[model samples]
Target chain A: MKGMSIIVKKVAQLISGLIFLYGIYIITHGHLTPGGGFAGGAIIAGAYILNILAFGSDAMNLKNKEQGSSLSESLAIFIVLMLAVFALFIGSKIFFANYLPKGQLGEIISAGAIPLYNIFIGIEVAAAIITIFLALVIFKEEVKK
Target chain B: MNSLIPLFVIVPLATSFLIMILGKFINGFQKTITPLVLLFLTVLSFYCLLNNHSNSYTYAIGGWEPIDNIPIAIYFVMDGFSLILLCIISLIGFLASVYSISYIAKFTSENNFYSLLCLMITGMSGVVLSGDLFNLFVFLEISVISSYALVAFGTEKEELEASFKYQVLGGIASFIILFAIGLIYWRTKTLNIADISALFHSHETSTFDLFIQILLISGFGLKAAMMPFHAWLPDAHSSAPSPISAMLSGVLIKAVGIYVIIRLFFTMFIVSEEISLLITTLGTISMVIGVLLAIGQWDIKRLLAYHSISQMGYVVLSIGIGLVLLARGVKPTVATLAIAGGLFHMVNHAVFKGLLFLNAGAIEHRINTRNLKEMGGLSKHMPVTSGTSFIASMAISGIPPFNGFFSKLIIIIAAVQAKFYLVAFLAVFVSVITLASFLKFQRYAFYNKSEHRSTSKIKEVPFPMLFSMIVMGILCLAFSLLAFPGIREQILGPAIDVLTNPNQYVQTIIGI
Candidate 1:
């Protein structure tokens, strides 16, 4: 029974990992196409939810989840703020100006600051989604209590 | 002087994270620390508003400059309008935090409640201060998501259902808003609101204009909980913890919904007869329907929730009247008076409605029941809560000697002045209905005789909660004094000036 449980947990973890990666792909390609931070982040959070359902809350070793997620959100916010600040030194007249040269439309370098913002947004959103879900899971009333 | 611009968002965001850290270490830091931080932030925002000479200030995050006269960076823009909103956000946020100190203690894991509360504040403050359309959308999402989570904080079956409904509807709104932004970018190739406004001003009318306007109105209308798109409001507002309900109904909807709509209408879109008419009609419908539905509700919070929709209708109707008058090039003063009345009521509603929810929570806290029929004759036991609720009820019902009276008076006056006599009559009729409904609320919740009359086993809530209610109650009386010419001249007038003349806002910030 122990071996079977371990195998099931490993399979859930693997599947969740793949799903997380796919969410990242969607977020990165958001500005170029359709999917964006909110959709991708929700998808990633869905993966975590699936893993928790399969393995139970105690099976996974998530570190300081609140602090971890909050730091991630803060870092994403910092990046957005920094990008806007970077515009100041470059002589842009206002904040968040697309200082980088627009390479070409439909290419990786196009859309100026749009992709950068999408990435930051993706990080913030993913962290927030995960945080709320984790809070709900942790705060659940024990069934037999 | 201009440096204080970022504090509006930063203070709440930082305090939220700080509370999370402190909450883990101390036994009751979640209860104590969160309220202190909120109080400090509220005072700080007020100080900033008072000290600043310029009506508008723009803070570039990390010092980003615009390229080629195009704004690409995120800007935290503060003006008289934003300051008015910021004051509402911080004050209500602080009071909610204070009330939550006691109210949330009934639940386990107090940290989560405080954390989510702060997140909501952060989102709201950011929405008020944001200068760009996309940034506003982002902040709005943050607020909506946190609120959805907070609504389900109770973890009851109904709470879950309500959150789910709110999320689905709110998600659709966000999607529409995002698509609208994409369309605008596709046409204008810029995300900055100012640049978009400037672009539209320089060019002639375009085909995509109406589409953008409709999309934005629908999106914000959903957030604002306007009449046609208000299906999710009663459930979400009633299901959340009372303080959270207060936050949702009092200021959150206005900040994220109506404020954005007004800003965009004035700044980006040219005032047109069709849009104005649509807005007015919708406002009138929401006003009538929201109150009519509210009268039937016996669940105290649910009734209050529906009233929020009703009150918001008055706001929209007044603003719509103003916009219609302005578009027709009629009496500009009448239009200003109309918008001023709307804005004034917005502030008044935030205080009284928020206080009312806190009062409801107080009753619930002592008796552990939300059903009004189950509550009775507890006024002697919970005097502070009852007295404050009386004050809040009076204020909400548009009784004289309170903030609600002045604004409603102004709105009625403006309607009559603008020859919108029918609208004026409807406005008075709704106020009467609002009064009648709350009288029922008072009779049932506090004054009605019940078998549990001697069940005076309940004591008043804790100091923090009572203190917040008292302060808000005091403000309810004090704010009415703004109707006096001198006080109005000092605060409301300047704020009204900023809205009426959009150029003053841009010029003050850009120093053009």
Candidate 2:
């Protein structure tokens, strides 16, 4: 599909970076705040989707990135699972045990393993949403072809 | 020992992700990885069964133990009942995965198939092991969603239509289950099964409680494909690939549907005579109607799908009889026998029906058609498939010396001893009709002469398919020995004990 008007593309370019940054902030601070991996990842995916809408699918190279997105999504999930499994191996011999040292309560990294889980989940969810979106786009293009 | 509970969910989930990620780059990663994961699960499940036969333990995730005697974390409850389900899931899952090694070669994106299969296994294991009601709901959704995708994996027009129907019906079942969980949490103020049972024991029943009971039965009934809610089975099971059909019919429905119903009704809710009768009536209708429908089917898979409903009927009917006896506080020994019979039939159906579906797949793989009318004289060319399928058919029909016969005999004897003459009669009648329909299946599919010249070129299926079928066929005979008292007490006794005594379940889990 073709790109939107130049004005729309320019505005999306300006805002997408901010959106992406905000999503990262939300993910990192998830343990201390309300928004966690799912919410932040969705926001980040929304940013990329917005860019695709304004810049067009070809310009964004979404078709090429689909495989990468899927791979990363799977990797993210694997990492989250490994974190839990590793805790079982190292800490209390229990699944999902918090083996990391607990920092001060108000700090961003205070909760042992929670922030790490959130970060992995964020990457996974974002990649998953992007994969789904790209798949739909590719399917539409195929039908047109 | 409690630590092992999470492995059931973790192993499958992690392996699924790994296969999806790594299989994308590696040519045959899914083929090797999927079977290994399932084999590991099968061995682990059997190990759990042997070690935990006399003990039941609960694992609290993240060490979120209860405060003030109320469990706050997601608990994984492991008992004889869940272990029985675990064995069935892993065993059938392994065979189905092995079968898929060759069968799925025709489908594109083999990695996606294996990944989805692993995810489905994770969901089923999670459902069977989770102690919290909402956790069960979550896992149920996971399983059902994966299954919807798997059912449509073939991408045929009919496959898509069947998957759409399955998703809609399954979605409604999930919603109803969620709504019931909400009502339950509202009433008892706890999500843990043991805690809820304890709360219900201390309080008097209200109208809302009965409403919740009905809701749960209908909700889980749809998943289990109880008589009224079974419309999706014929289409969905027949349209999916053969191994998938086996998984759906053999283990999936039992794990998500019948298993949940039995666990919730027997342990969570106080059983009453009226509810017990309701369940039995549902079972009887499904038994009779399911077989009647099967007798007229021309498609091989469709015929087997109908029988799934019929066989599930026997299980629910026997268990219903047991519940009725328990509710009325009569014939405790008879009640135990009835429930044991139900459980035994459940395992037997998993083996034989799984084999039957695999047999159908083998035939379809060779002949490239599902029509019974189009097939004939196949036993000559495919001795292994025909031989194994014949054993499965006889076992399912309750012929003597096979597993089905022993389980059915127990149900019948239990029914007679309890003076439920009507149930006993129907059980025997259904067995006869089952035998008749299967005879038709054999005559038309394998024994009858074919007019079509294509039968001459038909050959046996690949080694993986043949191997799975043989394993399931052996299980059909081996599981019959559960009737012998020495083995029965070890495998089936603990499961029967947990169900018969609900109070013990609460005390064991809650340590009260």
Candidate 3:
């Protein structure tokens, strides 16, 4: 559970932030680009994993964070479900009909509700992966104990 | 009514996550909410079933309209076939959840159990109602993945090992199914089932078309636990906790397995003689072989698990007989009878088999043993468990006045009329063997004079558990009335109509 070498730790601290930013960028631009919720979410998880690997899970308070992440994951998915159900009541009353007014085609907000879906899904996926990573690490640490 | 179709998938999925999040703060929330949601679902499904005027309904997700007569939207269709499936899913699900209120108390993380059960129900409902192929595959994964986790819920060595085996086999099955879907998509350029059917009907089926059928049958057959691909059933079913065992045995295999096989063959693909015979042959082999294997099992759940395979064989066999007759364009009445028997037996099996598993759970709850040799004269101790199991056993063995007897009689009559003397004989033979097997189950578990266990501390299960078992036992007898023509036409009639006339299904979904 100890941290890695000073060099590796410093390098991860420097690069993980950049990776986190990149993941957010990917998630935000998901509607216009190739990477959406899943790919960007994996990237965000990678950044957290990198930090955990360098600083050690004990330093990261990952065991406690696992609970919060899972709860967040549940909440994100619930929001997604609510969004779908919300659409069931609007306008013509379709389950997943996009209710938001469409913006211009090339804009970030162009696709209306699609971007909102991607963001929530991204959050859910990132939280899910982080929770899974934290769980396996905690299990390993506990088993060692 | 049509707007409610997606809610079958939606309500369960939403409640599952709600349990996961809300169970953190709310005391006794999982227990109360789980049964309430299931009860609501059961009532909703019944309302849908009875209110329908022999018509099918479809809902397109996202309000996407078909373009140029091609359905591009993800569709949920509630035809007669899926309606029957929906009723049974919600019914057994309600009962199992009620049973879990008591049964799952012994386990830690009660929230996780309920949440996963809800998720599994969501998946099965989605599979039943999905009109498109890819969504069906997605929902199948949702249910089975939850099942793998649920089977290993106890995390005991044996339970974990069984779940692992199931996952490996299930992963392979999913891959085969996905590959088949990909091929179908490549050929028809559509994911809508009705669309694919219309396209396949337009073109004479080629050898490549038959290959996709093989892939689908083998993939779903693995899920169904037909003879060749049944290695996972006994271990998985036995190792899981009893209520889960009931759900897995009673409804999971039917929803994701036999139901899909029947739906796809009848509506998605054109009926082929070779494939029909193949299905019948597989069903018969599973019937005889599954029972042969069950007789030797010492574990109560394992024995019931094997019987599940055998009984499922009855369903598949009768349906396959109908398929064969339909392929030959012969006696429509015999085909209808065979299919009616299959559907009736399927519903009956859900009730009796579910009751049987609950009984096993109750027995295991008390004595901490599933071995027959380790049990004796439990009829005096656990009256409800013993009494209900008696009803289930008699029903399964085709004794008269039980639902099983009527269904088996219809299947045998259909086989006889179709001139399949050997099939009729095997149907009779399998029923006799089933009788012997259950008699062994009865003698050792309930009626044996020998005192194997101390038997001093045993008592009846809690009211919630017994309540579920009693209702299922009542259903076992109540369903026998379905054998009468008047009652039969009301329940099994629509499901039989859908299977017999695939063109109607295609036209309805495509709105041609």
Q: Tell me each candidate's RMSD, in Å, in order.
A: 5.6, 1.0, 0.9
Task: Score chain A of model 3 by TM-score against the reference chain A.
Answer: 0.96
- Ranked by DockQ from best down, the candidates are 3, 2, 1
Residue-level error in angstroms, candidate 1, position B333: 0.7
Fnat of each candidate: 0.06, 0.87, 1.00
Q: Give the C-alpha lDDT of model 1.
A: 0.84
Stretches of candidate 2 off by over 4 Å are none
Mind giving the per-residue lDDT tens digits that candidate 3 earns over B460-486?
A: 889999999999999999999989999
State every prediction's TM-score relative to the real structure.
0.84, 0.99, 0.99
Per-candidate clash tally: 14, 0, 0
Over the stretch A1-145, how does candidate 1's per-residue lDDT look in tens digits?
A: 0123777878887899899999988888887878987788778877877777776766554447756886677667666666665664575444456777777888866877778888888888888887777766666624424
The candidate with the higher TM-score, 1 or 2, is 2
- Model 2 chain B: weakest 10-residue lDDT segment is B49-58
